[model samples]
Target: MGQVSDRRRIVISGCSSGGKSTLLDELTRRGFRTVEEPGRNIVREALATGSDALPWVNPEAFVRKAIEYASESLEAVRELNEPVFFDRSSIDALAHFERLSIRTPSDLKMLGEACLYASPVFFAPPWHALYEQDDERPLPFNEAVREYDWLRLAYPKRGYAIIDLPRVSVAARADFMLRTLGLPLSKAP
Candidate 1:
């Protein structure tokens, strides 16, 4: 295991609509620096530009662009003095490749292995009632479930501890995550 710094690279990851974004917003509101998910940004940009760099259209191109974004996201925090939260990590690209049954590029495989997040990665399991589709996330409930399973296996394979987030109110989830990381819980304003 790599040495963990006090400035943890915490990744909030899981299937779509599982409240990862909600918790990230809460953490950011509480003053922790955060990096948003690049997949949606990439998707929106690709669609806007009429590019074929979508997961379904061109999985390799999609992963390549995602990996690039993820790298930049990581680099953005390289000099940070406080713990930073990431909505997703580079390993997610590999998981997507797995979920899509797409061939994982050797370079992407290496990137996933090289870039690491702190252990006890927060995982938002599929919540059926809360699940909804959007333009960026069109994955159905069943596919989300499968993606969750793949994540459960993928993160651990990369030597991360999968911390399954409870299905609770977003505020409560934020508290739970802070508690899990031994950080003080935030008081309401």
Candidate 2:
């Protein structure tokens, strides 16, 4: 188990375009602190700056940037006392390295373990109906599903419990997450 202070730092991760962002938006709308997905932000920045740190262009560089971004995010929120939901973490970036058959650096593995998140990480399962391709997420549906499969295994291997989010409306999902965390839904504005 992680330090007590870290318990409220929850992580929400899974397949791309699997409603994770929508659920995070709903949580944010309801007044919870939320962290954006590192990968997407990295992609956007890379596209804007013409950096080589893009998943399709240079996966290794992209994952490294993700790891850095996630670490910074964790540090930035360390002082927050309320529940903080993260779209993904360094673990997800490490998992991407594994997916690419790249040798996982010891430092990266240690960083993933060092930056602890609350257990029972909520994973949004692959939702075919909700999945879509956009400028940031260009993976085909099948590839996204494969990524989800990889994530399902990754979280558990890292000693974090996995809870699959139900394929329901974003509001319902937010309620479920709060309920699971033993947080009061009535607190929502």
Candidate 3:
């Protein structure tokens, strides 16, 4: 399978409930393709099916599923010619393994190295005002902050530069990301 170039695959990641989803929604509204976060989908499915593949219930299973979902997401969009935004990627799954003190499988590590995202990965910094607990995201504010810390380190360790998205209106964030990518800004509908 061909790998998507780092420049065309953008990852929007960071703290939980830190507005990554909202920013992605804005980009989608402007007609960009986006991939949903794997954890949220996993949580939703686990809840509906009463499965143990939940982060709190079975973290190992959770991370495994996340890796699978993220990999599939990457593959699904590999052929797209336009910029494709991902809420989080397999690197986030690797970080979760780190958080749990588990050794990453060699294949997972290789996959992380192979699937490159755009440099200067955009991170939504911890936004206390915007943070809210939901069924899919049950982490407390402090834990969310810690996850952000881990991601801040993880992406750089994987050779990606980090760019923290400014705390501003979602539209403004979208415009900033587009401008930073040198893509044309979409006029408001």
TM-score of each: 0.91, 0.92, 0.91
* Span of 10 residues, lowest total lDDT, candidate 3: 180-189
User: 45-96, model 3: which lDDT tens digit per residue?
Assistant: 9999999999788887888888888878888887777788999988898898
Q: State the displacement of the C-alpha of residue 28, model 3, in Å, after optimal TM-score superposition.
A: 0.7
- CA deviation > 4 Å runs, candidate 3: 1-7, 187-189
lDDT of 2 by residue, 1-189 (tens): 865543388999988998998888888888888998989889999999999999988988898888888888889988877789999988899999898899977877777667888899999988899889987888999999999999899989979999989998889999999999988763446
- lDDT tens per residue, model 1, 67-104: 88888888888887567889988888888898778888
lDDT of each: 0.84, 0.87, 0.87
Clashing pairs in 2: none
CA shift at 110, candidate 2, in angstroms? 2.6
Highest-scoring model, TM-score: 2
Candidate whose lDDT is highest: 2
Q: Which of the two candidates, 1 or 2, achieves a greater lDDT against the reference? A: 2
List the RMSD of every prediction in angstroms.
Answer: 3.6, 3.1, 3.8
